[model samples]
Target: MRKGLPILLALMMASTAVGARAESIGHADLARLNETVGAIGRRLADTDARKSDASALLTGRLAGIGAKGQWQVPTFDTLAGKPTLHTIPVDFMLAQLRLQTGGKFAPNAHKAIANGAAPALFIRGGVMSLDELAKLAATQHPGAIEQRGQSFIAHWPIVIWSDAGLVLSAGQQLELSTGEGAFVLNSGLFTIDRASLSSTPEKNAILPEFRPFLATAMTGAVQAREARFSNLGYGETGVTSGLSIVGAALYPAKMRSSFSDSSFVGLNAVSLENARDIAIVGNRFQKMVGPAIAMSGVTNSQILGNVMMGTRMAQAIDVQNRTSDIEITGNVVLNNRGSGIFIANDARDVTIEANLLSGNGRGGVSVVRSACIDISDNVIVSNAQVGIKIRASDALSLSGNDLIANAGAGISVLDQQKGALISVADNAFSANKSGLYGGAASEVALNANDFAGQSPILLDGEFAAYVPELLRMSSSPEGAPQAFTIHPNAKSTTGQTSRPDCKTGS
Candidate 1:
């Protein structure tokens, strides 16, 4: 029995030592240990197990490292051109992985062969199992899945360059202005600049295929593709991202706080040049200094559900120069220094609806030299100027809108410099200085508009009231209603119909 016990104890000690050896400590301090080791001997010792294992590990892990020369290891210090996995034939490595995973390791070959060389790959890089590559491309990346008690990492095949990138919670965003193609974010976050966010990306040199990934929640989960944006003219360090607003409210409530003493921070935020598709919503902006949202030369973007506080500027929401197909809806522009919503020259096909504008500086909504606008269901009230002001553009329509209590007119049209045509219908105007104000009467056509103000009338530049019969000249009423300045009698129906007169051809 004593002999058996001694043998059993010896066996246990052997098992512990074997386990510790299997766990294999490679030098607690690799730098110090390598420095202490001096240099490798001149001649190759065929029987040296330690040298072979170190070489094998380094060679095995070399390709797995990213393209950007990482970790500056002494193994990479070239005294001799020892075996590097990077220099080895890719076919050999692929052959080994093929044997390891029974050919299921062919990440690209399977997709490429099936699609006949169609590039379904979002990014191109290092050899990894099919599963590993797919997981790397996910928004969550390395954290997307866990299996077999190991965290799998993949290597990038190509390198790209970018500056001033933003690493949001969901994905990494970069601005590669110089168009260098060696940038990568295999893990973690980075800041990229704006140049790469614009035309350079579209130049087709290297097209980035963003995969569809789960977006951060505004409400119920949505599958939104991870996008690479450019020219994101940002002055702030980090903007909040990851919340997907797919036909959902950017804000918690349907509306934002009113403009008072200016507590909002987004107003001070600056623009990014060549920027595109920036989601600026769900923020509070009241009593702001600049335009609540000002965009120039931006495209395919959305600015929804934000409040533009009163400002000294000419507009709360101003879009300028070649900006197209922008959607401005469900916002509140109150007491702004200028017009509530202003679309300027070269801005086209914008949709402004379901917004609330009160006490604006100029008009409620002003559009200049733009076309194909749809202005509907907006509540404009107490603006110092007109409720809805449109000038110098064509094919514009103001329908199903409510304009009330403007200091001047409810809706005003002037100086159609572009020979643009406008149609105003089914709108309600109440308690404005004048319900509808116009310059060239014949240029515009107003129909089915309900006006319920005391002096509901269109006027000339001189405030000479409108007479439908004398469409060209400004005129006042005659006799009971008055003249030069026509005052419609509150009692009489004809008085209500009568307007200022116009001299014949003069």
Candidate 2:
């Protein structure tokens, strides 16, 4: 009994601790929760009332319709008797959806309806609910109707089989859910002119798998794909190429505080994969987790007139894997975790021009294993690492760029593959720890750069054969020998000394 007393005391203490950790809801908190729940239920009731009113209005509008009419709204009992088909204008179906969902169509949708660009459908006669009718309409057309909270948002991704295309005019709003949005696949001439596409934050927080707002894919034969003047938010992605996104504001999710770290790859503002002739112009990409724009295996793409900022954990623009002929111009890329622009892995024929890249955690630009890159006319400044780091690449032309106030070397060219040709001409380098550092087998064509009041160019590795040329070009325009310096690891050539300055015999 004495030994068992300790065990019994321990069990009692454990139970007391467990009870102490348990929390009970206060009466006020419970009351608040009840009130919130009641409010939600009341809101739902109001929505149902609105739906009923709209349905009554629609029924009154179609009351005098007789049999064999093109616009027929048969009663549920009438539809149950025989299998009848009715042809209705697409806009009428949209109107029915608006009545059912208690939502409004975008102005672009109205304009399309007015212009007769909206398609007509032959709906089968059946006793179906409003949701059923919406599903049926979506199946017949290349669009979707999604139920979001008290509103059901409609999307019309018109399929262009011929020369005539679909156009979404200004002041339109579209809501999407998981696996439901607009897609232009194998279509031609798709255009969105000043519209808004959004995913409801309430729905997105509840539904984990959300799709993009707009996408174009496998459109090799398309004439054009363009989106201009739009506000898009709370989607997996705003756009996917092959298309041009111009003058748009793209957000990862609805404007909320919780989405600051929500930079999932699927939620990129623009994602381009295996795309050609793509253009992203005059756009804003902000508060995203992954890259603001990601291009993979793309060709002939241009990123112009864009502002990319406040990305969570990635670059503003990431180009990877065989992407060629890309021009990144007239853009502002700032305050990102990774490099502002990262070009890597077999990308070629790329140009970075006339951009402001600053305040990034990593370097402004990083090039790895790519060739034929032209870095010109850019202000690269105040980054965590080197302004530009080129690794294992060839055929680089670095001209007319301002490399300033960086944490590391302004320009670092390291581990050059054999027979690589690098050209440095007409650039300004200032206020960096080191202006330039060239490593093994760097065949640099150095000419006419302004390096006054900057650190000397540090050359490393073996340069026995090219030492004379290096010394000759090391002098400034005023003929001073301190502009270029050789690293200690550099091998001594004939008639040369191991000195920091590039002077005669030293």
Candidate 3:
């Protein structure tokens, strides 16, 4: 039933790399490796009475018909030169893993017995992720280590670890809350447009340790919009916490991933780290425990036009680490249990504009250890704490904004690090407990700020609110009130938040 006389008797190396596209077989050892594995599948099928002969088809041919009448084939388009990588069909890989345990393995494994070789294969399945695979492998069969960087000598020595390219088109439904949760890691080119991927609540009790999640690795690319991800995640840490793009930093500039016009409910967070060229826009995040969106070490991204509410105990937007070149624009952040926006840990070169920040538990905008941040044209109203809390930051501009009805001061410049310059003007301050609460160490210049009840009251200095000369706008640094040089490297972002619908949070 097979072709050619290419007899493959020798075992493959413990780790073998597969090319992305099928080319001519170059090395004799590779040809032998393929043919030998093919022969091993046939031999296992002949003796393994528990499995039907049709299940033994190991090639990437017609797998059994799916519940939806679609065929399930191997989805392997992986990187080059990865250790323990294989290009065989997924079923073929599963078959080969069954041969590693020699007929004594867990119930999850596909059983087989080698006539001359003693079927001893243990390829792990039904686990949530690769990290969980490492922990749960020994539970299936002892002394069976399939972790990366470990050496295991099976009858067929090559390891079978591959990445997946998952696509859920429109009008499709993917169930994640099955008995064996469907956790897809090492993701590649994932696209789910107008589709739904969710977990059912009733199935949560059967399995306790693992929850379903789909995350990307180094081979990352995503095009998800108008999609829904709900009730999927485990804890508040790791990429498995929710729908995440973890460590997929190799995305090209042009093929940026975006998750927009979507809905996420009852998840921990849309967590991302060490990735680039991403856009999270026009989405709704509700009932999230942590920040609705958490980004760290990301670059060249945008978070725009989203509505984030009902977060339990975290900010709606949290940008941390060495992230840069981001725009937080046209979003509605309301009633979060924490601060509305939090930018810290040297997150620089960001623009926060045209957003509604109200009804949050903490300050509207919080900045610490960040530079070159611009906050303008935002309605900071009715928050439980101060409108804006800045500490140890430089080159921040607050212009053409409204701060009203906040429980604390309108703006609190807590710690004024040296060389930090804040330019405040053309903003309305009304119904706050105080306006412009800063110490003598705060290097700020205020002009034309329409204060209603309270005005610029320096804690350590005298009140200069009604002084017309001090409030006069001055172009020269020496003539300006609280004269100091604005950071020359930082661009001036004054009066730039005049988009016609900025107030609409569109």
Model 1, residue 134: what's the lDDT?
A: 36
Candidate 3 lDDT tens digits, 174-264 = 5543333444443345566677766544443344645566555453556676778777776664466667765532332224568766788
Listed per model in order, the count of residue pairs whose N, CA or C atoms clash below 3 Å is 35, 2, 12
- The segments of candidate 2 whose C-alpha lies over 4 angstroms from its true place after superposition are 1-152, 155-166, 178-189, 203-212, 220-267, 455-506
Evaluate all candidate structures by whole-model CA lDDT and list the values in order: 0.40, 0.48, 0.54
Candidate 3: where is the Cα deviation over 4 Å?
A: 1-164, 203-210, 248-254, 453-506
For lDDT, candidate 1 versus 3, the one ahead is 3
Local distance difference test, candidate 2: 0.48
TM-score (C-alpha) between model 2 and the true structure? 0.55
> Cα lDDT of model 1 overall?
0.40
Q: Tell me, what's the RMSD of every candidate?
A: 32.2, 23.9, 25.5
> What lDDT score goes with residue 133 in model 3?
32
**What are the per-residue Cα lDDT tens digits for candidate 1 across 102-193?**
34223221211111222122222222322333344454333222222222212222111111112222322222221222112111012111
**Candidate with better lDDT, 1 vs 2:** 2
